[model samples]
Target: MREYEYHAPLSLERLFELAEAEGMEVRFLAGGTDLMPRISAERNQIPRDRKPPMRIIYLGGLGLDEVTDDGESVTIGATASLSALLDNGAVRTKLPALHEALREMAGVSVRNTATIGGNIMNASPAADSVPPLLVLGAECLLRSAAGERRVALSEFFTGPGKTVARPGELLVSVTVKPGRGGSAFRKLGRRKAETLSVVNAAACVELRDGLCESVRIAVGSAAPVVVRCTGAEQALVGKKIDENSVREAGALVVKALSPIDDIRSSAWYRARVAPTMVARALLAAAERKRG
Candidate 1:
């Protein structure tokens, strides 16, 4: 990477001042999992006008690394590592879908270094944690020198490798409210571990008196950004989640996708496998012990 001045600001205020001074040219170093390699590879290739910053602000001392659950919602700080999330008892018990996603993410070493904020800010179409977050009705907390605002995880991403975070803003935390039912996450990759997903799915469903009370489903690598299968969710709501209903909902998920051919898999393959993945997620969610 280009030689850059490193600033380790001890407080959020100092970090914001640096950001304000540098404007769009300042880059935040969270876990450095995504930033380091990308900057190294693209340093000499990108055009000058579009080049990323050479000023780095390390977030190690900013006290943003935390995980807190108040029984209603779980708030994960920006610098909280994926491995840390996996170790939290509350995360495992209340957010099974998220737990599953974290477990299926890049192996132990990578998880130990990758931060949740980095994963969200990277805005990858196949980001492992995002689908489960979406199903749990997660919201992102963004802060700047000016103030703070909350954006739903569904609305945080604008496109692949893009987000709505402003020039001076930083992602502070992600808050996920507990869903009213069982949840599950499933992903298909070239291998069992340490591989990017070809297709990933998450589902949360509430059953009442043998019928679906509410449901939320999300799929990744099927669109430009992780997307909620609202059509399928609507179809399943209030309906008995039987074999036919599950199959029909899965078909609806496929219909909602906008897949494209890429190095990992063909558009046809993604489209074909999407329904089964959705069905599997639903079945897994349905099987989760009802609270």
Candidate 2:
């Protein structure tokens, strides 16, 4: 990395103060998994020109580093690591689908270093957290010298590795509502672990009075962003979970995807499987009612 000053503020306010003065020149450092690799590459590319100070705002010390319940919903601190959530009971009880997604994310070692906030902030098109969290209807908390804003997780992502986070603002936490439903997450990657997801998804549904009371389905890597299938969901929102409704809903899901042909997989293949994934997830949710 190039030469520059480094400051590790013990508090968020101080971090904001430093950030207000530096702007883009200041990159908040959390876990440093993505930034460190980029920094290393930048240094190698420019041996002559002095690189910018790997000016990092250490998120490790930030007080927002745990998962907690607030009666109605769960708040995940920005610095909460994946490994930490692997064993959190409340999380497992309320949202095992997310835990299932995490367990299969990357590998154990990478999970140890990857933070929930970083994954959301990075907004990778193939990020495992995005699809499940989208299905869970999560929101993000951002803080900066100007103030704090609560943005829906769906709105937080702008594109690949991009977000609405402004200068001096750092992601503080994520909030998810408490829910009782069956949810499932699946990913298609080049390898079993530590691989990019070619496509991934999460489905959640609840039945009341033998009719689907609510349903949320989200798919990723099949579009520019993780998208909830409002149309498909509408098909199941009030109907009983039956073979015909599910078959039709699955078709709706197929219409929702907009995958692209790439080295990992083809758009046609992704389109074909998207509905199958959604149907399976819905079936999983419906089976819970019988048990």
Among the numbered candidates, top lDDT falls to: 1
Displacement of the residue 110 alpha carbon in candidate 1, Å: 0.2
**lDDT (CA) per prediction:** 0.89, 0.81
lDDT string, candidate 1, 184-257, tens digits: 99999989889999999999998999789999999999899999999999999888877789899998998779
Cα error, candidate 1, residue 253 (Å): 0.8
Model 2 TM-score?
0.91
Model 1: weakest 10-residue lDDT segment is 44-53
lDDT of 2: 0.81
How well does each candidate superpose onto the true structure, as a TM-score?
Answer: 0.94, 0.91
lDDT string for model 2 (80-124, tens) is 889888878867877766887898888988888888888888777
Give me the displacement of residue 100 in model 1, in angstroms.
0.1
Could you say which candidate leads in TM-score? 1
